[model samples]
Target chain A: MDKLKAIIESLLFASDAPLTIDKIKSILETEDRKTINNLLVSLTNEYDSQKRGFFLSEVAGGYQLRTRPEHRHWTRKIRLMKPARLSRPALETLAIIAYKQPVLRSDIEHLRGVDSGGTLHTLLARGIIRVLGRKDLPGRPVVYGTSKRFLELFDLRDLNSLPTLKDLQDLGQEWPNDSK
Target chain B: MKEQLKNKSESPYEVQLGETFEGPMDLLLHLVKKNEVDIYDIPVAMIMEQYMEYLKLMRIMNIDVAGNFLVMAATLAQIKSRMLLPVDEEQEEDEEDPRMELVRPLEEYLQIKYAAEDLAVRNRLDWDVFTRNVSEDTEACEKQDQEFVNISLFELIDAFQKIVKRVSSKHFMDITVDTISVNARISEVADLLEQHDSVSFQELLEGQDTKGQLIVTFLAILEMAKSQIIRIMQHVESGIIRIFNG
Candidate 1:
């Protein structure tokens, strides 16, 4: 058990990004998937129990050692990170991609009544939306869809968690001027 | 045009009165809803006049209406001209309404805009959620290494682990007698790097016979990257790592 803990600790510490149990298993040559996962969970619990400076976070489809948000004040002093704020146009483009996924670029442009090339580039760079494939149509335009990273970024459990238009309309019903 | 603009308050043309629109279609939708006009049965002539006035107002304010706005304007005019054509007494119902093309896409776009607005709300929420800064970004070096290949640190680690496993398996001897010091290994790697401005990971470890030599060489590479003497280049598409001397 100590051996397992030490190995996991070093691997997690050395990793530049979040890693999956599968990656660890392959490197450690351990066929026991469940054991590795359980070990990781226990490590996670141990970190929480001990009140460490950092905690294990399952994000972007893998496990990462993240500094505790409470300690962000101290971390922020060294971390001159940009506040990744998306413009209103980018958000609107993201919404279209999220709801009408597997949609063509032309479809997005037609809907927004404007070209969406720049906004799509921004979303792609951020790894929020990805090109799924080329649509089987004239010109074979590229089809796009939200990625797993998208769900992770939005704090959503899955695609099913995306708020529906009916939900938005329900919220709109409270507005004093919703005529129709 | 200026005459109608001055008498606009007398008409029922104040479409949503105070809303900002993202595009021409948005403005048109607001106009349709404000007057309680059916989208399917728009008063094309009246709506066309109302839209032009709105565009004029935008131009005065330097809002910079895009080309689509003018395109929609021409479309509305074309439809209005079709409306003016005398309806044939026979098979008149068979002829399609000119406004349907505009209405259908406008309706579809409006629904999408609603979804987009909802996502914008979620984007605002995401701002509150913080992520860790565990891995440092190589954005600064990325510009310099544009001529060099790009590779991720993960791929480098994966390759190192693979090579280490292969060498360890080739000889099961735990011989720790004459391992080169990490500092000495670093210097040797640096000399190899000085000869070649960029080298592949495999090239650096080539011809090393022992497991200890391979391991030391790998560690030296990692140490070099850590001390900023070199940058690990990962091919963006292939995930192959190369070393670029700083």
Candidate 2:
């Protein structure tokens, strides 16, 4: 059982993205999901109790080993990829699209109260949002929806993993809107 | 405000076009908060005055205020004019408040903005945590030095647009002649791939003289990519696309 846990750990370490339990089971040629689940739980607890440099995180509906945030300073030294960032306007536009998708560009523009053509183009180029074909209405405007890459980039298990709008509203109420 | 404007030597548009100026609604929201007014029963007369004052300031300073702002200004004026008219007692029972138009969208914008703020703080993939990365594929390990993003359809269109612009500008005398069919171009691209390990996207369009040839070649590339005959990859740093045999 310990050897199996180690093998699972190795698999998680070697895989590029998150590794699903089904994927692990398929690779290991096993039908026992319970045993694999038990092994993953033990591995997670072991890493936690040991206070290792990294820990297993459940993201995008699978398990991925990620470096701790506390070690980010040192991680920066060896980080090869450029840090990706989205501007405030872009994030606002993306949020509207993510929450209300299969949405037309006109809807996004109306909610944002700005012309979102450039931001939409940027998001589409980055593959964060995808064209979900045309709406059945007149002019047949191109509708957009969040892509799988959006979920992956945001570390969400699925769209349902997004925080509820009510939660955000409650949080917003707590803050004073003095920052102009 | 005048003193602050004097301190900045740059153009007014440059000074104000940063992350601060989100849109006309953002300015309205700012005014609402600054005045500490209720969103439900907004002091539209005052808010509209302040909104136009900002617009006037922008105009005086020669700031290129967006057309949306002007549209909002007109909306505010219309609402103000409606508010000035005598209330019709019979229609008042059926008519809704004019301010509701502005308030509804503002409330919706606020909710979405809050959602955006919430999203900004989540455990983002690259920002908060670094995942362990290893090449899961073994066959295509030849180009290990640089990472490649799968070229998106929109990016391909952008590249194609650039090609069209270049071809049209240089080949001014070239007539619209269907010299090569899309099928012929596909076979030509496949044969070219057979001869070379990889080819730059620009190199494939090197000898295509006519506008029709360029369009046909682009369509062939798209078809081949769709059929998995070739892979289109853009370098992470340079953004140069190269086609490889699939």
Candidate 3:
């Protein structure tokens, strides 16, 4: 591999979180984002072609080297991993906040037709959702939105990568995406 | 009817229902799917009857269905009654169907439910995939093992209750004067903190002879915490709040 490609790989390997293009460029003492991005792409493709135990994943607005899902059984034997488990209600609440953010608590409750206070608290504690600010309405209820941790946990490239309403047709009925 | 209402205990069926349904809209969606009805058109009267029957079953099972469910029931009843009235010919062009109110939210809920399912199956960082984070792994494990959380007001109040219970039993009839004021207790706490690096809440109230003195100590600690004079933290394993000079 070239020196730049090797450096990018080393950076991704050393870092605990995803490494963005800008971060790599700054570390390389260069301003050419394009070259850095190209090197990252080539390195990612090389790893894929090599059929390595891990692959490059684009997540949370950056690139990360993650072990392939199939290798989990053997890799997990080395150490205990306490996976963060989210309840169904928590997931539903996260979905609402993910799509309709900075949504009010009342908006979520109105959609679910239930009290979502407990689920909201769980999501907040899990660090996937966050309080953006208080709304400008009466009582000044807190508004919420998804966090970068949410994107990482969901393996999403960004908020736009969330499955649109059209993708849900296989699960059930299809409706026009007129929600504003 | 009266006998069922009088006995307030959870039935086995209530647990089953509680686990099955997340909320009233979830139950409604389940009903719609079970009946194979279209979303745009719903048989309001029939669904209302079944909805009320479910509520009645909850009542019989002694499950306190939340207020939101009752609110939905009232909404369903209102929609049913409105559907019963004659159609206004003049406003027919603009007045949307009353069922649309329920349909819109149900459709939105269903969309989000599927999205949640999609999110659930994604490649989670720790569960499905691993990263080259050997150093971070050890650091995270150490963090999990010895985590200290900030003590909340409720925890402080709980500690106070224990202190009160412990002191009240022995000094039930003793009428002591309020000699130890809050200001005096504050200085005493400050002096103790100056001497020791840290002190547990129980240790601070160790030798209080009267309930009034304990109350003063608790108030002084609260005031200190509010003024940023002392930091209150509790260990996850021991659950003991310790005071530190801020």
Candidate 4:
């Protein structure tokens, strides 16, 4: 059981992406579903008690080990080697793209009240956002969404974890409306 | 009172104000204002000292000062040291003002800061108006009721692939055909349906030697139906199709 737990922990830690229970079971060749569930629970408690920099959470139908939000600042600083300052236009554009993802460049431009074509290109080059797909419309404009790297940088669990307009207003922005 | 004064002086760079300084430049500007130094002729040495002091204070308080702050400290030290050096004739003759070069970044930083503040204000006000308009516009587009449901093309392809795989796994004898036209197969199936008035979809799929041949025949039948070469009748609930020769 100790060996099984260690193997599960190591597998979870090493994976760059989430791993489902079925995949884990298949890899381990163990039919003991109850043991795996108990091991996961114990590991979660151990990490919680130890106050480790990482924690395991289920997301997108799989378990993933991620850096705790509190440790994000130091991890980001260490990884980046320096703080990158974003321009106002870039920040605003990023905010808009993040909240209204799978949106078109034209729609983003319409929202921002400025020409965001260059900014979008810069963001794409930076790998902060990506072209998700082309909208099935007359013009067939490309849709954009924030990348996994964006979530990593922002320390967000998912898009739904983003601060709502009400949260932004509470943080001292002006009017609040949950548009997207 | 004297002991308290000493304690305060020892912690001269105490972070009394809120930690939110917007950016490194904002913090530098705040330090400049606190020192009552002119923005144009910023006392680089004094500012650098204060900046370092603030960083130390932040460190002592266990506040994680971002790398940008440290970078600004390095830049200030570089500028201050440069200012202390005697300028040679070759360097002095350069068109750009040394002070202007130093202050240009500050001006740019301030401009960006104010621009962000302005944008934040606009986003708040404009979002409300945009949401109202969007709700009204989308009210007419009730077609979105069906559109929002998740249906991936990959899932459809996977289902088709599974069907093909299952059909291939079943052992069957290979049949070589010199002139078995798809038109003949379609007409035969249609005629069988016409005779029986109804036939199982599974019955139609059987007797094929390979999965590839079965898929090809099925696609041909579908193409003919699309072109109105044959009419397909089906019960609403049961997805079973009955082909009719038209």
Model 4 alpha-carbon drift over 4 Å, by segment:
A18-23, A30-38, A57-80, A83-86, A170-180, B1-246
Worst 10 residues of 4 chain B by lDDT: B130-139
Interface RMSD of 2: 9.0
- TM-scores, each model vs. reference: 0.50, 0.66, 0.67, 0.36
Native contact fraction per model:
0.28, 0.52, 0.52, 0.02
Identify the superior model by TM-score, candidate 1 or candidate 4: 1
CA lDDT scores, all candidates in order: 0.65, 0.73, 0.72, 0.54
- Give the poorly placed runs of model 2, Cα more than 4 Å off: A80-82, A173-180, B1-21, B89-94, B134-246
Better of 2 and 3 by DockQ: 3
Cα lDDT of model 4 by residue, B1-246, tens digit: 123223223323322211112335556766665678877888888888877866764454323466666677778877887787788878677834455755876654443334334333331211111111111111111111111122111222233344556775544234333323455667777677668754544556655555434543554454454344544444334534444443
What RMSD does each model have against the real structure? 25.4, 15.7, 14.7, 31.6
Model 3 residue A141 CA deviation in Å: 2.6
Kindly report which residue pairs in candidate 1 clash with one another. B150-B234, B150-B235, B151-B233, B151-B234, B151-B235
Candidate 4: which docking quality band?
incorrect
**So what's the TM-score on candidate 1?**
0.50
**What TM-score does candidate 2 get on C-alpha atoms?**
0.66
Q: What DockQ does each prediction reach against the true complex?
A: 0.11, 0.26, 0.29, 0.02
TM-score value, chain A, candidate 2? 0.88
Higher-ranked by DockQ: 1 or 2: 2
Where does model 3 exceed 4 Å of error?
A: A76-78, A166-180, B1-21, B88-92, B134-246
True contacts kept of 1: 0.28
